[model samples]
Target chain A: MELGQKIENGMEGRTGIRNEMQMSFDAISENEAFARLAVSAFVMPLNPTVEEISDIKTAVSEAVTNAIIHGYDEEYRQENDRETKKVQLHCRIEKDMLYIQVKDTGKGIEDIAKAMEPLFTTRPELERSGMGFAFMEAFMDRLEVVSEPGCGTVVLMEKRLRMAEEADEL
Target chain B: MENNYSENFKVIDNYLMVRMPEEVDHHKSGYISRTADDYIMKEGVGNVVFDFEDTRFMDSSGIGIIIGRYKKISYFGGKVFAINTDTRIKRTLMICGLHKVIEIME
Candidate 1:
């Protein structure tokens, strides 16, 4: 099965997919904004509310930032190894739900549970607020992080959009 | 006295007002914090006002910049203020507990 097919099959209750797009870019700080803009544009067809768009943008920003800052170490980049230092973003819309996955092939987290703590940080000297995961969790309806030491980390986020008729009830 | 450091930074009265750029992520936050800190120390300004009228997005890095500034100014009986924040940015600030330390002005 194709990647899209795999994602669709893995997710239950997906009535129908409206669109799907996948992109890969170098793990650089400048690409953070680019990732956000790309995701925003891809999801535009859904006519998401301003608040919903903001939530998606913020979540993407956090995930990309993590891939750039914590994932790829400076020493690794200094070695001029570019191929393995890539960030992949996959987004798809099924029915009223938007699914996004950000994956990095850099240093992975050892303890997922500890890292998810609101104020936990590995690089405190860098002045990191340590709220990256917290913000991602707050902005999206569902979040999942999978990582293995010395391998990579993947962040999956999903948001359910309320149809116009459904929104009116609220 | 008035000193304009750049197009985005200016000192008015006793408040050092900074007009943030469109996006304030980790890449830009460090530079902003350093420049603002220099101004506060050299100019001895007691109040720092952030003008976010044009900012569209800010992440945890932006929060760190604001909190770092709050710590700097508060050390010398100074205060940090934010003006013209939109709903999204305001919510980010509130969630990070910045409203408790920095004053958000209308």
Candidate 2:
């Protein structure tokens, strides 16, 4: 299986310290908790302080919520006939660093650059702050988004664990 | 959980107290903005303090909510203060530049 496929196949606490979770929801705003729970499980083992954990959870929530709210535009709720739109998440921990990838099989971002700007959300009517990437970038050390217009979007984030003293200082 | 907003006014002193619910993110920003705007219009209470002791998580959107109110209140010769932030909420608010604009109290 390919790396992404392998990650999807319940690769948790194995050779490379990777964990993958899969769930398909109606992509409704109210279902944001499901996405948060999945990412929390992946990040909990990193031994992040309580505050850090919350930060990670919030970042994950924003990304997955965007996938549901913006990417699918609430269409997934009515797509009972086909069940096409779904959001996926994959995470791995390697060498004192955590990497998270959120994938969405919905409308791909047409303008990645514009989408990343602070407070640049497409769903203002829904009160979206358009600060999804901004929050992710603020919490994690690095973030990357790869998408093809007709395909999908994959958001990759990496956070290096700070040394004990460094964490205390901050 | 849904965010709840309520305001109390000190008639003689003209200070406003805003009680914000948990997790001020994208979903709750607009509601917060509207509530603050309403307080400014109805009570004419400009001096305000936000109590975040119960708030667990806040994203960048939350910053916009605070900044919007800060700008509005400051224009009328008033200031805003935030109180009792947990570590997680504190870091998030700081990262979004809220620390520079408002007074933070323990």
Candidate 3:
């Protein structure tokens, strides 16, 4: 079915939705857990399967972690005296698809292609797996990244939900 | 079976057994890695077993933790084993090419 037609058909049903939410918070380690839980809760109405929910949580955690650990370079933050660096997350649900966007206004990647390579990391000394993008791609139906050297980075991820077993009630 | 969501580590018959929490993501990976490393080095143990029976969720960070532990123990000629994995987590391990290096046991 065409994407637009599917959305239209979905809206006619009781379970269809066109909801969206955006949140901005400090780029701190503790917020990683918060981000995962928030995303999980936001998608609760979809009644996703256990495995599906887990996949979504994991992908969100990776993106947020990347924003905190790699995006805001510590040296840069200190030099500029900017202690309140923030990361933004936007989530939207349209029909059977869930879309997530994580943005960080920190040191952007010079080469996104190289950064996406599995096992490639700039901080190997820190034991970073460098598998963030790889996992996000594997778990989600689609993943995209846009960044500039000094501007910032944004990661967009999309996943198609499997029909919930009890969706009829919705 | 009782479900314990807490992460723990203990020694069983000369093998270090690490009990993972219900969810293994970036938040818990740092603590798990640091604690496991300390135990392995201090105890001078060779073999390590990761108990994932209680783990319902795991991301790539889980893979990285396992691989990191494998590397640490293997440096001393020790082996790493994983147990109690469900189909989904097993598939993740396979996708990350961990099954080729770490032994999975029932």
Candidate 4:
């Protein structure tokens, strides 16, 4: 099943998506850098400013890291199926707006609202700063989280580049 | 100010100086924390200063690293300082209300 078609969202109806991509990888800490760097490269065509690129990269890092650390519980190994738990990185670029969705099929969030609260971490003993969702909300123009217990979680984020707005003015 | 560099770690003026990596994320947090703690426990540094001069990107994991180190030393009357933070790092710290907790040297 394609992750893009898994859920219905209000954003799917929007047209003019210039580009789109979906990738699935094993849920592992090492892939965090791979995920964010790939996203930075994907958005390069938008000619984002250094600050904008940093913002996008940082947001992507938080979402993917959460999926790995919280979702699969560090090392993902299924006792029955032994299938590798996967984290899906999906992106859509429409005009100047970038849409991102990081999905994971693992132990889903029990309470998303409480999870989003700043400094409210479920794993403080791990020295988690409890700022993952907070930073995502700060860096992205819009952030939405949908999760179900014993199923999975998808973090949806959107950002509009200033360069794109300047182009619209011309 | 003896530059005794040991694996991205240094000690200056009794402060443990941790030179942050280029990209600080969850993958690297564990290692960073373990090494910094060694200094706090073994070397007995008075304070901790995180150097972000080479860091171009940092996620909440960076915040965790800093906060974890701060907690380790604070009970012993140690202070945590962050130096060379770029706009992104600064904003990350500010968003989490970390500026109030740690001294940020811009």
Q: Per-residue alpha-carbon lDDT of model 1 for A13-52, expressed as tens digits? A: 2344478999999998889999999999987666578888
Q: Which portions of model 3 show Cα errors greater than 4 Å?
A: A1-15, A164-170, B1-7
> Global lDDT of each model?
0.85, 0.70, 0.84, 0.86
- Which of the predicted structures, 3 or 4, would earn the higher TM-score when compared with the native? 4
Runs in model 4 deviating more than 4 A are A1-17, A74-82, B1-6
As for DockQ, the candidate ahead, 1 or 3, is 1
lDDT of 1 by residue, B1-106 (tens): 1133266888888899989878889878777888888889898888999999889999888888887888778988898998999988899988888888889875
Model 1 Cα interface RMS deviation (Å): 0.9
lDDT of candidate 3 vs native?
0.84
User: TM-score of each candidate?
Assistant: 0.87, 0.73, 0.87, 0.89
Compute the lDDT of residue A5 as modeled in candidate 2: 83
Q: What is the lDDT of residue B60 in candidate 2?
A: 64
lDDT of 4: 0.86
The residue-level lDDT of candidate 2 at A150 comes to: 59
Q: Which stretch of 10 consecutive residues in model 1 chain B shows the poorest summed lDDT?
A: B1-10
Q: Can you write out model 3's per-residue Cα lDDT over A5-26, one digit (the tens) per residue?
A: 9876764563666789999989
Candidate 4 lDDT, B60-91, residue by residue in tens? 99999989988888898999999999877888
A best-first ranking of the candidates according to their DockQ comes to 4, 1, 3, 2
Native contact share for candidate 4: 1.00
For A1-170, candidate 2 gives per-residue lDDT tens digits of: 59888765533433244454555566555556666666667665544666567767787887877776667765544553446666777777764577788888776899999999987877765545567898888878898999877577888888776642253344
